[model samples]
Target: MHDDHDHHHHDHHGHDHHHDNRYSDMQARVRALETVLSEKGLIDPGAIDAIVEAYETKIGPRNGAHVVAKAWTDPDFADWLKRDATAAIASLGYTGRQGEHMRALFNTPETHNLVVCTLCSCYPWSVLGLPPVWYKAPAYRSRAVIDPRGVLAEFGVTLPEEKKIRVWDSTAELRYLVIPERPEGTEGLAEEELAGLVSRDAMIGSAIAGAAS
Candidate 1:
């Protein structure tokens, strides 16, 4: 089933406005710092933009999507991923810093998985690239565990009432990657095509894989 939707009118009752404001302030400070550094010839604005662009386009969710697609097509790899996610993922050439230790949370018809770092923003940067600002917010960290269903609702993901919501806490030592359920009508699709259906949020459990069209 297609479980994801655009949250055009989601309620923000669960959000901590204070945290949002702080995040905004932090971003502004960062931009100001970047400007000062560039003016002083201490940093190259073009290089900074290039690095950010690489992460956003080349090294981001596409890496995770490839892994998910491979798992969907190869049972042996899927088994290996279930057995040792870190090694299985590394076998695909996706390995490094924040992703040194990894775990794969496979979503199923009866259950959905959501990942969060309660203590801090411990994320799998190797595959998923930089984490989203919301993922690092204090509100998200605290609420994802206390009220996962409500949190998912905020992301426009509404699971069946009978389906269980499982929340995984990521740590500096180990991080998680959600493997969303493969959408229906995709049996004939190739792996590359399948990868296109998986979104960054889907792998994080805030959204579902796109339904085949």
Candidate 2:
């Protein structure tokens, strides 16, 4: 079953919006500091933009997406994905901090899992490109562990209460999401199509891997 997701929306409830943690404000501050250096003839602001663009585009998600695509197609590869995510992923030419301490948790029809950071939102920057806005929501932080199923239902996912839920505390240094085995009926599909069914939480373990219709 393809789990419903509302990626179009960004939940703002319980946001840590004290202007102290705003992304824009953070960007502005960095820009401001750079401008000061430029005025003093110490740096070139032009260089930062190019560097940021390369990382955001040329390096990040492409690596993670490729790993996911490969795992979906190879059974032995999936084992590599779980046992030692970094080396397993590095074998494909992708490596580094975002995946440095990578841990892959495989979900199944009989088991379901979800990832959350009660202290803070830690994510796989290499594959995900960037964390979704809702991934850092205060509502998500407070409620996910206490009411995993209810939160997932909001996104059109409903799991049986009999299944025990495990919520991993994400930290600044470790943890990664790799979703579980894909359901049947997806046997003939290509990697690109299969990727679409991987909801953000599917990889994190909240829902089972869905076969696209």
User: Ten residues in a row with the worst lDDT in model 1?
Assistant: 1-10
What digit string (tens of lDDT, one per residue) describes model 1 on residues 71-190?
999999999999999999999988855536999999999999999999889888878998999999999999999999999888888889999999999889998999999999999999
Q: What total of clashing residue pairs does each candidate reach?
A: 0, 1
Error of 2 at 206 (Å): 4.7
TM-score, candidate number 1: 0.74
Best model number under TM-score: 1
lDDT of 2 by residue, 81-152 (tens): 888886787797765544357777666656676888788778776555566678789998889889888887
Q: Which candidate is the best by lDDT?
A: 1
Evaluated against the true structure, the overall lDDT of model 1 is 0.87
